[model samples]
Target: MIDALYVAETGLQAGQKHIDTISNNMANLNTTAYKKGRIEFRDLVVGREVTSLDETGKRDLVSIGNGTQISRVWKEFQSGDLKATENPLDLAIRGGGFFEVLLENGEVAYTRNGAMKVDEDGYLGTLTGYRFSDMIQIPPDAKELEISQDGTVTAYFDNDSLEIGQIQLAGFMNAQGLDSIGQGIYVANDESGNAIYSDAGENGIGILQQGYLESSNVDLVKELVELVTAQRGYQACSHVIRAADEIMQITNDLRG
Candidate 1:
């Protein structure tokens, strides 16, 4: 009975984590370029022992499983739907890649959110003020700003077109291994490999789409189903715990 209680406790903890992950995915359903989270579970085996010898004199091994635990929680990197905003500054990647941004701490960060804006210094940056790593700057008097599929920036002034700096993208060997630091930003780690900088639409990188933004990749229906499953699992574990306690109480009353 004591072992049953412990096992059910583990189940409750794992089920709660699963539900939390599902809730987080649903909460970010409307976020720009948001990736959904996936939870993995592993069976917890407490011990293994030889129970007895078979008729052929072979040992029979019995493995005891305590419960289940959360093995990992990884982000799904599938591309989301592209939404057209009709704003030239809004950009979206059509394939695999991430936008490179220069943080205030002089470190490079990666993101899929492409809602960009011009800073006070005419430098192109995210709405939250993270400057583009390429340092592409727009002229103060420029008009008709346009970014081509190849990430070539251009503007017209005095009926003449001027070329701005090109926007570059970064790729990773294991993008799922990147560490997410919120705000749709990620940082490279050892498991993620180093950032591979490339020109847009080159070297397997994605092409940039001006006047568009990437929507969050969360699927509402899938999350709702997962939430239901997790809730049932939690309830089942609670029942197991309750049953173990009641049986223990009955035994104690009979002894008295």
Candidate 2:
């Protein structure tokens, strides 16, 4: 009976964690370039015993399972839908890649959010003011700007056009291993490997789409279904705990 209580407790914890993950995913449904999170669980075994010997002298074993535990939580890196915008600075990736931005602390962070803006100094950066790693600057007198699918940046002044710079993309071996720092930004770690920098559309990198932004990859219907399942699981665990308590109470009454 005590073991039943411990097992149900583990189940309750697992269900709560699952619900939390679903909630987070739903909350970021409208965030730009947001990736949904996934949770994994593993079964816990408390004990193992040899029950009997078979005809071939092999021992028959019985394993006692404790409960389930959270194994890992990872981000799904699948591409989100691209949304068209009138702003030329807005960009979207058609495949696998991430935009590199220099943070305030001088550390380079990777993101899929491509809603960019020009600063007062004519320097192009993200909407959050994180400058591009390469620091592409536009001339003050530039009348128009254009970005090609291959990430070539050009500025038009009257009838003449000048190539200013090129936008580069960074990729990782295991993007799911990247650590998210909120606001659609991620940082690379040992598990994610190093960032592989390259031109857009080159070396398996994704092509750039000017005037478009990537929408959040969260599926509302899926999250709602998961929420329902997690709630039911939590309720089932609660019932198990209550039953265990009642069994203990009955045993005490009999003894009395």
Name the lDDT value of residue 215 in candidate 1: 96
lDDT of each: 0.93, 0.94
Worst lDDT window (10 residues) for model 2? 45-54
Cα deviation of 184, candidate 1, in Å: 0.5
Model 1: residues >4 Å from true position, as ranges? Answer: 48-62
Judging by TM-score against the true structure, name the best candidate. 1
Q: TM-score for each prediction?
A: 0.93, 0.92
Q: Give per-residue CA lDDT, model 2, range 1-256, as digits (tens).
A: 9999999999999999999999999999989899999999999995565867889898866778999999999999999999999799899999999999999999999999999999998888999889999789999999999999999999999889999999999999999999999888899999999999999988998999999999989999999999999999999999999999999999999999
Worst 10 residues of 1 by lDDT: 45-54
lDDT tens digits by residue: candidate 1, 1-256 = 9999999999999999999999999999999999999989999985555868889898876779888999988899899999999999999999999999988899999999999999999999999889999898889889779999988999889789999889989999999999998899999999899999888899988899999999999999989998999999999999999999999999999999
